[model samples]
Target: MHAPMPLISTMVGGLVLAFILGMLAHRVKISPLVGYLAAGIIVGPFTPGYVADLSLAPQLAELGVIMLMFGVGLHFSINDLLAVKHIAIPGAILQIAAATLLGFCLGQMLGWSLITGILFGLCLSTASTVVLLRAMEERQLITTKKGKIAIGWLVVEDLVMVLALVLFPVITEMLSKEGVSPTEILYSLIITLTKVIAFIAFMLIIGKRVIPWLLIRAARTDSDELFTLAVLAISIGIAFGAVELFDVSFALGAFFAGVILNGTEFSHRATNNTLPLRDAFAVLFFVSVGMLFNPAVILESPFALIGTLFIILLGKSIIAYGLVRFFKHSKETALTVSISLAQIGEFAFILAGLGLALGIADSKLHNLVLAGAILSISINPFLFTIADKFALSRLRKNTTLTDTTSKETAKPIDKQQPMMPFSDHIVIVGYGIIGQKLLSELNDANEEVVIVDHGKEKVRLLKMEGHHVILGDGISEEVLTLSGIAKAKWLFITLDNPYETAQIMQMTKSLASHVKIVTYGSHLDEIEYLYDQGAYEVIEVKKDIAITMASKVIPSL
Candidate 1:
């Protein structure tokens, strides 16, 4: 019989074990990451029985990093990122410095060299992207202000780590007993930074145009398989190219690729399409990391492990919390951000590996870093879950103060858009660009209207402006009822979202069968479908645009 293929067997073994453990973790009310890592340790070469292919594991896991970083880029919003940069940029730098100092002190006590200590300190300074993103997702806080700040803080850390990766060799030589020249250090730093900057510039300037245009062209082929292939290609291809040409990390490359793609209209579709693959590969990534961990380190270097964990889990967290509170944010925001940064992952492992290769970190340090990472990551979710409850409880106690408070009492009244009740009026769903223009024309014609929007901020602004607005999802029946859908003379759904527009139309028909429904679709392809979904009239936006342009340029036609 032919020998079992390591690739297939490794994937199968890791996935199966991870699933069993993940399910158990779920039942016990813990992060599935705990189980995934446990699964890795079991199949890892350290534990002995049915060890997964050591060499093959990393190759599989690397895909996970590429895909996960790619997804990060996909959701990386420039506008939201900018809004929190004031705090995120400086906060991340200071917090990292604090953690490094704590680690350095601990390293010095252990009699480690300056270079080894610096490497150790750097390893503990950054949090795992996988762990933080999962925590935020579990709590559905990704779009909240707290989530935005935490993500932005992480972005800065990732950038710093990327630069550190560039300067790794220089720092190793400069800080060692056999020190290098200031000129050599400067030369290396300048060269590494130049490559990094050039990579970012190229990705933003050239990649921004090429990537979106490429996706648009691929999407026009109307092939789901091809579109998915195209996205994966861009993500992996750029990640590989960045490492080869620019001496940057593949994760950074994939991340920028996602950021550029985020600017396109097809971004949402792209996110939904590849999310499954990203998620699957992400599981592999965690499992592979687990495989490298030697559980014996717990018994082998008990004190060292504890010290590393102290710096990573407690020290770093305290620094993050204090820094956030120092900036005058509420206690809840501080706690959430603190908990988010309490663990280190991919970068720590990368640093540990590099340290081992360069003889800067001893075998003891390497294993301790792994032990610290595994334990810290496993424990992080519980910390977040506890913080979440505390914030929730505090919000309930004083709704006006805490970040997690419900909108009913916590939301400030928008003085600009005051609410007014109206009947025998049009109810417009989706206050997007088209909806806004339609409201302007109808209001000018003395046609009373009430707007329903999903965005809390938009609804607040409209309510403050005195243009009757309901701050709830248009797809919800309760929201429609609250918007006076039953009494409204007409329901005009101006949103170009065909799926949502159809659902709303169906709901409107069921609620008020006689209510007139007029809707707009961005493409003529879905016009008939919308009509079938109970729209009395469906306006085709692109077709109308084409007609208008034709009328302007060729009036006779």
Candidate 2:
């Protein structure tokens, strides 16, 4: 029998293991990221099983990072960042400085050189884009004030790391040559900043127009395959070009590419088409991280591991919390932002790998960073749960105090009937064509309807039309609650994305068991899956259209 190619074997093995473990993780009510990581460790060289090609795994993982950052860029606009800039920019920088100093101190205690310690410190200073985004997406916080700050904070961190990556070689060379002056370092910094600024300008001035025009052309071809291909090509091509021509990170390049395309009419369509690839590659990225871990680190350097975790989980979080609170944000927002950034991932790995390549950091430091990443990521969800409960308790206490004060100071007024809360209403999850039609019919029948949609413009228009609308992803619990799902008589999901549709159905079923859910699907398997997920009715859109056409023509005949 012929041997399988290295690339093929690595991809197959990694994905198969990730799926099995991811499912198990889900079954156990933990983040599937835990399972993906476990799968990596099992298939890694450290274990006595079929090891995937270590060389190729990282390359694939890089693609995952690129895709992920692109997705973030699509959702994130320059305006969103500006809104949170007062906190995100300064907060991220200060927090990074604090974390780096802590890491540097720890490295000094371990007897590492100044350069090595600096690099080590830098590795632990930044949060992983994948982990933070995943957590925010799960809680439906990506569009919220808190989510915007966290994302903005992360963007600042990523930018700093990119600059560091550019300057690492110069700094290392300076260290080697005793005659190198501070002016040389300053010049290098200026040059690097210029390149970054130039790249940004190019994207905003040229890319914003060109990328969208290309997508519009592709979309006009009326081929789903071609449109999707165009998106992938643009994302990957721009990312590659950024690295090669602009000497910037792929994540930053892809991010700008997404940002440029975010203004286009086709942004939503682009997101839907690329969602699956983004998800699949993200899984591989986590697995690739796991494969780098050596379980022996726990036993061999127990103190080192503890120190690393302490810095990542406690030191960084505390610093972030302080920074956010100092900026006059609420305790809840501070807690959420701090806890969300408690782990390090892709950028850490990149920095660590660069340190190794440059001979400034050793294997031990790399392993420590990897171990820290795995442990921190695994426990991040549990931390969020604890934080949520704590926040809830505080809110309850405040509510109770307010109620007590109201009772003590209340004066009797002319007795008046209180306004009734919205209930027994129909909730429409999307404001697309089907949603618009449903709303019109429901309004004509005198039924109360609440609209839940992610499109800002759509939600604004709906509200202007005097419709009750919650502007957020339907999958978010907060959005569902705002839509009054508990008292909703009928829930209609008009979203085109099957994954999102299923998620909405499942969340709705859990939140309001009595409400009926009706959704439309284009495929038989998707329809069946939606039914399995507790959808009351799943309309087969294509089948329905065909049947309707045939019925009309046959009647005429």
Candidate 3:
């Protein structure tokens, strides 16, 4: 009988344990990353269980890294990046330097060599892309100014790490030699930089044109399977090719691939198609990180592990916060950026592994970095919660202060008059095509309507057009209150997302039981569920469209 395949066993074991633990972690109201990491530990060599093929797990994790970076690239906005560059570039560089210095100081305390200390410092300097993005996305901060600054800061860090990875080996090799000429070292650095510049130039100049052309062609086939295949092929193939040909990291290659497709017509579709794979692989990436961690390090080098965590969670965060504050950014922005960067991830692993292979770092150092990564990633979300509470409290204090000042400065009136709230008005949750049409009809009928939307540009335009608008998620209780949902006669949700519409209906019902909720469902299955959720009317979109079209044809006949 044939023995079990290691690849199948590892994949199955990793994914199964990850799902179970991830659900448990979610149930406990913590990040699922903690669960994924715990799953890795259970099946890891350090634990007394059926250990996975460590080698194969990392290779799989690498694919996850590629996919994660590709997703980042897909959402990457050049204008957003440019908008925050004044702060991002300087803040990132200074924060990295400060973190690196902290790590190096720790290394010196540990009696490590100069080069080893620098390498260790470099590993601790950069934040994890996966962790930061997930945190930002979950909090719905991806479209905010603070989020743009954080993402831009991350892009700068990634670029610096890419250059560091290139120069690392060359510097190590030079230090290994005696009497190496400055000219030779400079020449080597120049050559490495040239290769990187060339790869970027080629991707931007040629890959941009050719990759989009290929995607368009694949899309023209009118087959979703083919389109998805083309997307995956482009991401993985370009990443693999970049490593082999240009000597760049897979993350960079896949990132540029996603960037090339970012603004294309099918970019959103491409992102949706690859999301599952990206999420799966990203979990694997975290698990692989967990496997690298040895719990024994907690006992053997307890202080060192503590120090590493300090650098990752505390030292680096303080530096980032200071840099952002120094740059004249708001306290909220500074807190968000600093806390978001309080974790080291993929690049740290890559650097640690490289150092170990080069005999520059020992297994102890490697395990310390891994332990630091696992702990930092798990604790990051909690830090964000604390930061958010603090920011909210500060906001409340400032708002109260401003209100008191305005009250004292105002001229005394004969009697204080209360502002009237909108009542007997219609609340529109979205401003899409359907929403626009409904608004037009309502306007013609001379009905009062209040608009609630999350899009900045849409809200600005609505306000400019002299419409009553509230800028926030429709399902938010605060947003609904601001829209006067409690007094509104009707709530119309024209959002394309059925789940969000259902949520809005529930929220509206809770706030204003008498308010009628009218929404649309894309599928027949959703209509009953929506109605059960307290929707007064659920228009089955496809059925309604067919009926309307048939009416037009029959009338013509």
Candidate 4:
């Protein structure tokens, strides 16, 4: 136990440090994980007296991970999962197994225990939700088919991580008991499996049926705080119940609770309301992760640090690229999806926690994992940009049937069909430069293009030019349906708000998977997120166009 007064002061100080560091990283266009890791180094044994109460930090961090997982679960609807189920589950399992084997081999070479090696591999399998999700939003690929698979893949990993969490403690407990045998282990496994099955069935089937009714009833009271509290209560309550009654992880329950509410009409409202809470607690989670690093281990074994970083970056990328391509996705799709999964995530910290508690990991190994996670996460966005460049080069070189581009596959529009139903058309969500360029190119090529803009004047102008236009915000479901988005062949989101674009794209993907989507965004980092959201193509307008012009201009001079 920690001294209360000192603990509180430590926590407050740690938070302040984390905030400042995060702000600096963001301002300098780096991942916040870099800031968090730097904070950890500064507050570690090497630095001055600002070190957080390590004992208390873990507890608070647990709460943060729990809430974070709960929020993840809430975002995952059955429909959303089902839409990308084929790739998500199998792809994740295969990736996990492959990573474990590789990690085991690497550990053997490093002279570590097999169990420790396996734990390290498991840690590598978990992709950072914060990093990947942020990247997805930036690229506006959140509605593409590739995006759906990426998110679904993450969802599967989240489930696996939670199960691992539950199993670790139980296995440790059994190992300590008298007459521990294969038979006893098998019995325990069966019992645990049964409980998990029951818990999932209750949450998805029973809870799904019950939760929306409760939310609706609460909403009728017209109290915003009440509604918000009820949302938290349900999330926290079900999560806690799973831990207490079913012997499961709180993250799993919270996630399933969100899945239940996903079917409701008020899900958007729920997401809006809960986002503030998610952001606050999420900060604590990152801060705690930052506070765990030991500079001594890193200094003692720079080789190990380098080796771990290599495995995190190169190992994951190779596996992701292979798996995504094996699923018959395009090279560009495969590359973006692969890059998104290249880093270890928040779940690694959770797994490390389990390992520490069970004494499966030594301080050196724990610090190594923490350091690797931080470094890998920090460079992830930059890595995505590199991946995209490689993918684009590959796309340009490939002339096979697998090559999917506007010029190669899409049919030209017929002059006779001027009033073609918006069905089987690409819906352009904005009329900005990228949107206009895409519209013009697609139009010239004879592909069906229907434009939607909230600017009434823009709509009128498009109409005057004999282009089909819908006047409304693309973020709204009513506007989407009215613009014939449900029937359209692709969704082209050219909006400014990365978050809104992601949400819209996700919803659009849910409605139609065959309808491939291609969108544009302001940042290269967001390309992965756009891929995860279900985009078939994510155009990084700033990087690609500017770089193209720069090359031409430089060469001419």
Top candidate when judged by TM-score against the true structure: 3
lDDT of each residue in 380-400, candidate 2, tens digit only: 889988886775455334311
Can you rank all candidates by TM-score, best first?
3, 2, 4, 1
Candidate number that wins on TM-score, 1 or 2: 2
- Go through the candidates in order and give each one's C-alpha lDDT: 0.80, 0.81, 0.82, 0.75
Candidate 4: tens digits of C-alpha lDDT, residues 1-557: 86568567756776677779989998877787777667656765556776666777677777787678767766765565688787778888888888777777777777877677888778877788778878876655565666777888887887788788767767767766898998998889888888889999988788877888889888999998989898889888998998898988776777777777666887878887889887767777777766777778777989888878877888877887898888887776777777888788688887887788788777777787888887787788787778655643442233122112223552333322222354678888888887898898998889877787755467667765767775545655545665666678778888777667787877676656677777766666688878777778888877877888898868753
Model 4: runs farther than 4 Å from truth? 1-4, 44-46, 177-179, 391-557
Q: Which TM-score value belongs to model 1?
A: 0.71
Query: What TM-score, computed on C-alpha atoms, does each candidate reach?
Result: 0.71, 0.77, 0.81, 0.72
Overall local distance difference test of candidate 2: 0.81
Please, what are the lDDT tens digits per residue for candidate 3 over residues 1-557? 98979888887888899999999987876668778878888888999969999888668777877887788788777787798999998889988888989999999999998989988998999998778887876555666788889999998888787677667877778878899998988887888788878998999898978888999899999999999999999999999988899987787788888988886888988998888888888888778767777889899999999999999999999999899999998888899999999999878987887787678888788888988987898788789889766754553343111111133442321112211144799999888788899999999999988877666678778766767776666766656776777778998999776766787787787878999999988767788888888888888899888888898869753
Candidate 1's error at 294, in angstroms? 0.9
Clashing pairs in 3: none
Cα RMSD of all models vs. native, in order, equals 8.1, 6.6, 5.3, 13.6
TM-score of candidate 3 versus the correct structure, residues matched by position:
0.81
Error of 4 at 323 (Å): 2.1
- C-alpha lDDT of residue 22 in model 2: 91
